[model samples]
Each structure stands twice: as structure tokens, then as C-alpha cells.
Target: MTPKLVAGIEPPYYTAVFTSIRPDAPEGYAETASRMRRSVEEIPGYLGHESARTPGGIGITVAYFRDLESLDAWRLHTAHQEAKAYGREHWYDSYSVHIGRVERSYGHERA
Candidate 1:
């Protein structure tokens, strides 16, 4: 699927920025990732997300939520927690998660 920037999200929201490098032979990674993406959409305060991966295997996914509570919900989600454990054991070479609050934001697009 093509990656697109998430638009129309107002500020005072929270973002979970996940950055990672995949190990060689990441079996079941794509399917698990897709499932996680779908799973996040079902969570109550999910706003949106943007994700991309480079040819060299560096990847980043930024997920937006309406508040810290929503972010925590995602963190404790059973499926998401399982995915995280699987990633650590079999998929990722390295990864980091950074959570931040967006107080303001600005952007532009050409049509």
C-alpha cells in the first residue's frame, strides 16, 4: 500500500512515533504489521497514522490519538502488546518508541 501523510488532525493530541530497523528474514512481519494497523483503527481515540520504510530497512510509523489515555490504551492493547513482543523476538534489529503531545502544527499541500 502507498503511504500518505495523515491530514486534518488538530493539535493538543498525542503521537506515538515508532522507529525501527528490521532484521534480515523478517518472517510474518508484513502480515503482523498489517494486522496491527487494522487493530489500531478499532481503538476509540485513534486519529490516524503515517508510515514509511526506506530501502535500507529503516522504518517509522507515527500514530495519532486524541489524548494520553487513548495512547495508553493502545499501549496496553493485547494484540499490540503481542505484536511488540513478536517484533522484539523475531522481527526488529532495533526499535524505539517516543510519545509526545502536539501543541501546534502547520502544513501545506498543492493540488
Candidate 2:
């Protein structure tokens, strides 16, 4: 789905990040993660996100944001807060978050 970017005259600023974690996860972790991914897409300023399992089947997801404020809103969201607690309590063995500025991006189209 296309993101609903905030209506502002300023050019968009993006944050690009990828996270990897250990494989000690709860049962149905993959399914739950899929649901989580879909939910993230519903948030405002959520450009898109995708994840894949590593060679060892550890999960990695890259989340996109339209701006720093959008990123912070996602970080502090209530349900997201609960999921984070759950991850710490039962789901994830360990995980990481990386924040960065997206200086440039390009898209391709079929000729």
C-alpha cells in the first residue's frame, strides 16, 4: 500500500533501518511477526516494511519512515510498546535497532 505521507511543503526525510536478532523465539513467532508487519503498514507515515529469515532462519526486518517524527511515533505507539515488551519477555531472544538518514533512493520500471 502507498504510504499516506503528511502534507507538508518540506521535502520528505526518510529513515532506513535493518535489524537482526538471535533465533531463540517463541512458538508461532513467524506468524505473529507477519501480523505485526501488516499492522505497521497501517500507521501514518509508514512507507513500507519487509522481512526475511536469514540462512539460519533468524528474522530480519527493514522499516521505512517519512520523517524522524514518524519514526518516533511508531517507536512510542501503545500497541508497539506492548509488542516490544512481549518480545523481551517471550518472543525474541535478542534484537537490535538501527537509525539512519536515507540520502537517496531510486526506483526502476519495466521498459
Candidate 3:
């Protein structure tokens, strides 16, 4: 299946698109990931997010924040930092993070 392009916030917002390849059923990963997601939502300036993963364990998660500073805050969060370390040591085989500022946004929806 194809990955979906996340619908982002209004222009001038920031997004962090994280893509990762993981081992099959990595232990403790699901719990840690769920905790991290919930934790991020409570942070100031968090807008929203979209995430999906393939059957092959390739996944993409796009997290939106009000600005670069908010995004940086998440990146530096202690729990988040620990999760990143765990990903490097045990969960992910490879990963990539792309950050961008949305200049414009338009979409169509059927009623």
C-alpha cells in the first residue's frame, strides 16, 4: 500500500516527517511509541499528527508544530530522547527525519 501524504496545518507551520524501518515485532517498541505519541500531544504548540506503517515494517509519521521552536522542544524532550536512543540501539534498522515549513496548503473534500 502507498503511504499517505499528511494534511498539514496552515502555512507558516512546521512539520517533522519521520520515516523508519524496523524489525519485525520489536519488543517494547509499541508501548514506548504509544507513550511518546501521547506525551507529545501534551506539549505546547503541538498541532497534530498523522502516521502509518507498511506490512513490511516501514513507517512514516508526520508531526506538526506551531514553529521551529516547538518542534525543537519535542526533539529535546527527555523521554523522547530516550526513545530515540532505544530506536538506535534496538528497534529501528534505519530511519530518516525531514523538517519543513509549510508555505501553502490546499485540499479537496467531497461532501
Candidate 4:
């Protein structure tokens, strides 16, 4: 399936891509994930995101922000820090985070 798209988002933004392999017994994982989404939205410069997971439990979530400073704030958010620790200790078998500037973007849609 296609990952859910972030509607109305424009370029010159920042995107944080998080990729992870799930642990077998991922208790409280869903709850924490939901909270992280909500928390980032409350942050000053959050834009939106697209997320998807494979049947094998490999997942990717790319969240967008207005700038690197906003992205940096989200990274340093206390709750996010806790969630990162939790993923490392309990939920994810492995993970990687990549951040980049969206220099330009173009798309097409069929009506």
C-alpha cells in the first residue's frame, strides 16, 4: 500500500525520516507512537508526515517541519527523547533517523 501522504505540504521544508525494525514484544509501542505524532504537531513549526509499515514490521515515518530549527526542537522535546529511549530499549530491534532539506518538489494528480 502507498504510504499516507501529507496533504497541502510545500517544499523548502525539512523532513525527518525514521526507519525501524520492530521488536517481537512491542508493548506500549502504539501508544507512544501516537503521542509522538501529536506532540510534534503541537510544536511550533511542524508541517505533517507520511508513514507506512511492512508486514515484516519494518516501518518508515517521515515528518515534515518548516525549518531545521523547528526540527531541532522536535528532536530535543522531552517526550520525544523518552520515546527514543523506549524504542532503543524496548520496542525497536533497530532504527535509523535521517534529516534533510527538501530543496524542491513537484507532483501530479489525476482528477
Q: For this target, which candidate reaches the highest TM-score against the unseen true structure? A: 1
CA lDDT for candidate 1? 0.89
lDDT tens digits, residue span 19-87, model 2: 656565557666766777777777788777656667664776777787887888888877778777877
TM-score of each: 0.93, 0.71, 0.89, 0.89
- Cα RMSD (angstroms) for every candidate in the order listed: 1.5, 5.3, 3.1, 2.2
Q: What tens digits encode model 3's per-residue C-alpha lDDT throughout 50-101?
A: 8879989999998989999899999999999999998899988899999999
Deviation from native of the Cα of residue 57 in model 2, angstroms: 3.5
Please list the residue runs of candidate 4 whose C-alpha ends up more than 4 Å from where it truly belongs after superposition: 1-4
Q: Candidate 2 — which residues are off by over 4 angstroms? A: 1-12, 16-18, 22-25, 107-111
| Residue pairs clashing, model 2 | none
Best candidate (score: lDDT): 1
Q: For candidate 4, what is the TM-score?
A: 0.89
lDDT of 1 by residue, 1-111 (tens): 644688878888999999999864478987888899899899899999988788888999899999998999999999999999988988888999999999998888877
* Total backbone collisions for each predicted model: 0, 0, 0, 0
* lDDT order of candidates, top first: 1, 3, 4, 2
TM-score: model 1 vs. ground truth: 0.93
By lDDT, the better pick of 3 and 4 is 3
Local distance difference test, candidate 3: 0.89
| Clash count (model 4, backbone only) | 0
| Candidate 4: worst-modelled 10 consecutive residues by lDDT | 1-10
| Clashing pairs in model 3, backbone N/Cα/C closer than 3 A | none
